[model samples]
Target: MTEGTDRPRIIEYAGNGFVITWEPARCRHAAECVRGLPTVFDNTRRPWIVTDGATVDEVVTVVDRCPSYALGYRTADGRWRSAPAGA
Candidate 1:
């Protein structure tokens, strides 16, 4: 926990299109992230998500591939979004 145990910044975007959340830790190295959008979710990287690495559109495209709720997205104005069920 070198960066501090408080938790990495969990980005939850409730936008005109979707309500999405991401928990980078529970990701389980599925690589769904990096595979879907290499520019944003690179394996040979730190701060792996690199949300800034891609545009919000690109990020959402990749995040949608996550099998775990480690990444999630849905219609924004339809249902309220949440962070990792219990989290």
Candidate 2:
């Protein structure tokens, strides 16, 4: 959960060109992220979401396929895209 709130936890992982956010509570384990880009979404690794593993465009493409909207991203250019409510 988020600090001082009952909302499910949303973790952020930042890289040089983008920032990725993940809401575990919203994940359906669709595997879109892992299958689309294993280097970036490897659950076997600690702090699994590694934004730097791929380019901003590549990351955004995969994140857009997340069926549950558990994955989201913000680009360095100030464009924000995330869960429906968060977006």
Candidate 3:
């Protein structure tokens, strides 16, 4: 189950032009991220998230599918992005 009341653990992976953020405590492990973008969200990897594994557009699209808001992103330009409301 996800942490509903506590602050989540946030991890970041920076790539050439974007950064990916992961909130472990909030992850449901439903594999939406993995299914959507395996190359970047492979749990078998040490760090799990390889921001450079895919293009920025690919990363953003996959992250938007995260049902728990456990995944997020920021561009090199410093624009923060996240799954849409009610997602």
Candidate 4:
């Protein structure tokens, strides 16, 4: 099911200030994202990324905190998500 298709899927790599994916293989786990944004990057939360943790706009800000591009974003219209400010 895609956006505007069936059911709305949960946003992945989403967080307050930014959204990102957990590329296990690519993830270096340098704790940069976590250190930068704890409220949104908590490990306890499943999927680990809460777009609603703050605001879609806010989440984009934090995801940029990630030194590595392991996390990403785009529009919610089935398009790949990207960080805000074009980070």
Report the number of the highest-TM-score candidate.
2
Worst 10 residues of 2 by lDDT: 78-87
CA deviation > 4 Å runs, candidate 3: 1-7, 77-79, 82-87
Considering lDDT, which of the candidate structures 1 and 3 is the better prediction for this target?
3
Judged by whole-model lDDT over C-alpha atoms, candidate 3 comes out at 0.82
- Model 3 lDDT at residue 56: 81
RMSD of each: 6.7, 3.5, 5.3, 8.2
Alpha-carbon TM-score of each model against the true structure: 0.53, 0.85, 0.78, 0.52
Candidate 4 residue lDDT tens string, 5-87: 63323345543433455544445677776776777676677756555556555455655566655665654434444333533
lDDT of each: 0.61, 0.86, 0.82, 0.55
Candidate 1 residue lDDT tens string, 1-87: 366676655666444455556666766788887778886667787755454435556656667667665776665345433345465
Residues 4-76, candidate 3: write the lDDT tens digits. Answer: 8854478888887998988787799999999998988888988788766598888888888888888899986
- The residue-by-residue lDDT of candidate 2 on 1-87, one tens digit each, is 556666779999998789988999999998999999998999889978877658888888889999999988899988666777653
Stretches > 4 Å off in candidate 1 = 1-21, 72-87
Give the C-alpha lDDT of model 2. Answer: 0.86
Evaluation by TM-score, superior candidate among 1 and 2: 2
Model 3: per-residue Cα lDDT at residue 64: 84
| Top candidate (lDDT) | 2
Off by over 4 Å in 2: 1-4
Ranking by lDDT: 2, 3, 1, 4
